[model samples]
Target: MSVCRQAARQWSPFSLGNMPLYRVCGIFALLSVGLISFTPPCDGGNILVFPVDGSHWINMKILLEELHARGHTMTVIRASTSWYIPEKSPLFTSITIELDEALEDFFELYLQEHMRLQREGGSAFAFFKITKDFMSMLSTAHLMWSEALGKILDDKTMIKSLMDSQYDVLLTDPAMAPGVLLAKYLKLPLVLNVRWITSGEGHFAIAPTPLSYIPVPGSGLTDKMTFMQRIKNLFFYSTVVIQQKFMVGPHYDAICDKYFEGGCDVISLLQEADIWLFRSDYVFEFPRPTMPNIVYIGGFQCKPAQPLPADLEEFVQSAGEHGVIIMTLGTLVNALPKEVTDEIASVFAKLPQKVIWRHKGERPSTLGNNTLIVDWMPQKDLLGHPQTKVFIAHGGTNGVQEAIYYGVPVLGIPLFFDQFDNLLRLQERGAAKIIQLGEVNEHRLEQELKELLFEKCYRENIQRLSRLHRDQPITPMDQAIFWVEFVMRHKGAPHLRTEAYKMPWYSYYNVDVLLVLLTAVAVSLYSVFVLVRCLCCRSRRKPKTKQH
Candidate 1:
């Protein structure tokens, strides 16, 4: 039935125009290389997935695809208002919960406003405004998600169905923590496909982060910090803590109180996870303390390059020796501010390289014939291409990982959120250069672009990273799968999970131990002082007796 088998059965060597033995051997080589595939057998397991609806879903979907190929059944819980998480898919069965309105469009409206504020910002007042606006938006998003989660809980039939399904594991993105709640409620082994947790970066929730060295996400500092920078990092970290404690925590508190016996705190629940498939590697991330259960499976989504489409191939080939430059701002943003785009486009026009930019909205007036603008691109393939010289991007996790995978240097234009932090990692490694939106102009863009392109260090550094990433004993994807299935093989991995979450804050930090030790030391010191005083008094009394 197979092509190789069919060719073998036909026995066409004599019929093929008197072919030589070497040509016949070449046919066998083709069969061995192309027609043979060794697919490992799989044990089909049921997996329940809860994913956030935007860029987070992309990673979740890729993981699900791999699991599905390995004979796993998947069920996804999504919102009716979700544009990205469709109601139907071949890979997973969907359970769509209705929402009052689409949240994705709501987020985009605010994204535009944030970009506008960032462009206009020059003073402390402007920074305060951005932080205020972001917190308001975050609270609203949490409020909506919490309400939607409440709907799922209130449904008796749906609850019964989920319980009856008896899923082996619940795979979730913890950015939106309803999945975590569901996993706990169902008592399934929780495996998080995570980068961001409920309040901030995932590490802070589960790992012991020393503020002395490990920089906070938005502080824009590296592992090595100055005195003032350490103070600034602490301040930034406090804001994240306050957000989780005061603002976002309250949104879910009501639900937890009503549903669970012991009222659940989401952060603690997150720390109790059986496995955290963290979406970062130390090669790309700053070195920090990590837990036993946390698996580093960064760049799991990347793979070898695929052939380019005919038209795109022709365009790339036209660049010849100068090579091509690829620029994209990720899924959330369609376009940058007009002035910024005009500046970037103008600079691209002046360069000798070919450009492929993924952009929407108004085309820049200064567009060049060398540059091609499209609504979408085969991002990974483009990065993998030999002709791709440098990447100009927004510094999302996916894009950054891909750039590292393919050994491409970047000139980053970080707009908002963790984009700056993500890009800063590469800049620290000397693989990228960053230009802010507020600072963008023809001169800055041209200078950075040329530096990234012509400077041999940028290319060399990223390539070295690529080697480090590739030299692992096992692939990241395989490592992730092994862990996921390991969870399934054992009902849970509580052995690896630390009991640190259950301990009180005082006990966890050893404040109680410190207090006991301090008290004992003080008591011993006081006794020694009293004995010494008595001895001195006796000596004085002896002298008085002798004089009498």
Candidate 2:
């Protein structure tokens, strides 16, 4: 700098050397060229996705989008009767399969009946009835998937083509098992985008889940269980076992026999997955044992709020100090039963706060001027909004995760499946309240809403959760993407997966070893005892002679 100053003083024209912008541009250009020259280009991997329809497809689609953005080629296998998974998409090329039966009505009926039984207070008769219904539903769904996959397998051309594609990893949600079966048939590395599987939650399938803490889905129990709670957990677990062995297993068993050299095990296949992008997090989920390959990417689908449409903004602004309450029952059921909706609507009508409800059913007569009923609302955007106060939810994983992400306290009306369990976790932490379907009346719902709205603790606790959830070193989405890429970079992640799944039950638990050791010790003791007795007898026999 001193030399430059001296030169500047000697020649005024030389002062143009102070033009650092030109120098900065030259340096930036050099760095850019260097980076371009040295940095290895992205080698896109081929990914095959087999996703279940409905909300499961939604999750798979998001993951596919991220993989697509990262330059990976994606192909999604969807069903012909799928209501949600679009045949045409910019994200991935979809291969639609033909289905003999459509399952939308079947699931809808099951949910309706389940909700009705829950509303009937879940009596013993109701419990049995619901169990029968669930099994029937489970059987039909699996049988459909099994047959669909059989058709695909029978088509030599399609099977050959999929194998020819040489996909790096086969990504699937194990809610149904065709994908796992297909992956095995194709000999591709498998990655599961999962929470629910055929049997129960994915954790129960792969992790060492003890009923002492890990509550079964639909069992409104938490990690800290009372004695009776443990029994209830077992009972719920029994339901899951019945679900697996009786309802879901036989259909897949047939498929396993048909294609696999030996009978295939869906649960075992699930355990063999290279990576499990589990849709849960410790921040939201109760602490439990997790496998190495299981990546908790909870709330990954949630993003920052975007601008609301004009009318929504105006309605939200109109709420002012009272703020708005938003309600949505995830993807499956657009509306609850008439009586339940009426009860909820009546409560919302009386509230000072404005309400935006995503209800597709007939409008309630009790719906008030303060409430706005729409077919759909931008859920995450509303949750992120400053004016949004409380979220009324059906306790879907996505909704509960989003609630945690946005720090919104929930007033949950869990209808079926894992909904109650999801809300139970939030309630255990005092971040939310659950009102069961049986007890959902105007008086009860109104009371719950008032408490959720007025209570400071609920807001504070959930916000604390939000902070912890946001405090991660890497975002959940990025972590998920990294593991997926990690699996692709290395053909499969067998090192991360446990070999215990391959072991027989006795071997896995070391029962055989324990029995062998026990037998050796017992035989040694018995032999020593017999020898000592003989020695004593000999001594006794000789003692008479010695005394003489």
Candidate 3:
């Protein structure tokens, strides 16, 4: 049969008219039941995804794909960043803001000024001042992005347009705090997907309690902080609280009042979120104490192996027995100081292994025979290859996950941010050694390389962790999809929420104990005073009676 004729015969309602009326009605009923069965329970619902670029969004893409496969729809709203290379798809529609362009321009101007100052032989004090100024500028740029996002969200027309679509769930990066308000206003299920670790305040509604708590995973050592450290931590938390209150809290409150009947607390809005998803694995971010509503669905960004590029394949093929060392500092911190680059080159020169370093822009002059510099690399593919042995990395979470996925040991040279914490976790797990940025000399680099290359324990430990990581009942992607669907199926699982949301800070910390002690002391002092007064009165009454 011709294709069109076959489709017509299958779908034509007029053809069914020839049958008995009862038979036609039964056919229509059966068709309706089939249609309902095929359709997903949810409608053409929407999801608002922010920071829609980078590895963070990769997992989100996977979830969207799953939902799409199941016959649902989503809309992504995000800031533009180069990290997210666009893949053309009809199912996905993206709304991107130009925040990255502004940030790029600001950083370039700041860099040019700082470089000029350095070229002018600026003093140490002057250099410090310039650095501080640059940091302030960066912070200001971040704040501006947040404010612009807030303005977009606050527009009545924009909110109504988005609401008209009747979105079922709002998924946002924890870095974008404005999402909480949008979710609250719409009265939708807000799922905060945390891409990185931070205090559970601000955008990180899914993180563990004691919001700013840092876990020293696998350390197997827990001790109380010294008094000074406790004081310092308290001061740091207070500062963060103050900054976030001004920058995010007030705007959040305003948005909530306009949308939520002017009757909601900002923190209550976050606490009432439908669910929280973290991108960290339990093995990596172990010892995390989170409520039932918070789910750890890490490694969703990881993928099975793919074929390596021809040039990379040939490069590895050329390196016979010594194998290859892959080095990267991630995408953001591409600019390494000249001293560090030179030291890395020197160490690579001494090693027998062939080194492939992903260095952007101009190459250093110290290139040696066994070394090759490339602007980029297939990091996971290389890690999976048998010829690839060691990863010298900056300890970014994605890089670390890839290394662990392939069971390749790492020599971490962490520079800043969570790099230190990641390296510490790896070191505790006995799968890696760290080279602090300040101490990245040729000697130390060489020694660390030697240990990673020759040490059997590092390899064994990594392989062990890889086994644990892989032994899960489902892939991280499957687990993530399940939880996301669970939320949709259940219509917001408020029962998973904890009592932490109800208590004040003082009460949560048992400051009520101090209050009780103080009250007892006051009562004791008052009793003593009453007793003394009674004795004085008795003495005075006795003297009066004697006189009479």
Candidate 4:
């Protein structure tokens, strides 16, 4: 509960030393006036947010609450597919809608197939097989979500109410086509809540992603690529571009057509986005060209470490000089193969350091006295603890950023998706080490853990990174809030929008410029050669006509 709510619940004349009723009421009135003074200006307009109904919702929560606290009337249109719900606040309201039944069913089937393939030792063929199915699932779900959103928009009364509300801005997750389409219909300035640093297909639509250095998120390549590695990265990046263009783009375009009259392309809305608040920072990410509209809110979800529960604190301190290691694979990954978990437990038992593994499944029999198996652990709090020696993780963007914030060196065991790329980059930066799941074994896990724990270099690198992350003039969250209101304050801040969004693909890449330069050089070379040949022929003819 908020402080205001707590005070209201405890407020009473009797509690105030038996003061006169009028005096108590006067004190209450003064407190109320103070609270009113703290409230944001009444002129703050409504801001509507539409987030995809999974982990993406978790990513948007902090920013949403901050906006509400600043006196903006915020409404979030939620989908029924969410695994968790945000805490109820009087300042923010939510409207829930169910996804298509077929989508729900397909998602279950897709999850099963995906997990099955991932567990079967992620071979090259397994990678392709899972990628194909995941793409198909994405297309089907996107279409169904679009249809579900169309129904909501088709409701005459809802449309009337939305139009009447006069919402000033629409913030949305770029992955959701429905949200983008709705923002267009409402004719509000759009802001994207991109919750990851790695450049994905959706991000490619809004900004220029150079293929030379920036590797695709899921591709198992680092920024510093050899010639062959560069070619491989290029192929991988190009394939994603093609898939988004030929496959995802057309489906979303059709979705827009259903409700948007003459219709619109999804990329059109992305191009018009006033700001792209990325969950990224330069400290962790490779240096890349960024536009003015891009805002980095990397550690917005992180906060100062609070006191741990007594039991956890006692357990952590029991390790003494050895310290503690926190291991978690993030929210989506709940289980590993029992054999793999057993091997991990075996590895943990041999280590001198105490281990806290956040396992969501049945505990393995190989568990050690030094290891504590918990269904869920406060990950950030554990990492922030001074006794923390190392962090073993799946190398998620959030997890990696947290490790950096707390100065914990990571031993990444990447399973799938962007985990590989994230870990690879960290390894390149000397702050972390990677142990691929396919290569994970007792020996490997133990070896990497030892390196991560005892190595002065690893700790030094992360501490340096921590300094860089903290040395910013303003906190990332405050910077994000400033820019969010900056958009509204300046009516979309048109000056911040880059000219890159307005250019065609060929023009943006300077293909036309290259073509013109090549053409001019070729023409000039040909003319010079022809002129020389003519001069030679004329000289030969003059010699034949004279003293021959």
Name the top lDDT candidate.
1
TM-score of each: 0.91, 0.93, 0.77, 0.85
Please tell me which model should have the higher TM-score, number 2 or number 4. Answer: 2
lDDT comparison, 2 vs 4, better candidate: 2
Instruction: Single out the weakest 10-residue window by summed lDDT for candidate 2.
Output: 10-19
Each model's lDDT comes to 0.92, 0.89, 0.69, 0.79
Model 1 lDDT tens row, 486-525:
9999998999988999999999989999999999999999
TM-score of candidate 1 against the unseen true structure: 0.91
- How are the candidates ranked when ordered by TM-score, highest leading? 2, 1, 4, 3
Please give the RMSD to the true structure for each candidate, in Å: 7.3, 3.3, 8.0, 7.9
**Candidate 3 positional error at 535, Å:** 7.2
Encode model 3's per-residue lDDT on 144-260: one tens digit a residue. Answer: 555656667667787788889877688776554556666776777777676532222332343353423443321122223455555555664554445456544555455556556
Position 536, candidate 1: lDDT: 95
**Model 2 — TM-score against the truth?**
0.93
**Model with the higher TM-score, candidate 1 or 2:** 2
| Total clashing pairs for each candidate | 0, 0, 0, 0
Question: Which pairs, if any, clash in model 3?
Answer: none
Model 2 whole-model lDDT (C-alpha atoms): 0.89
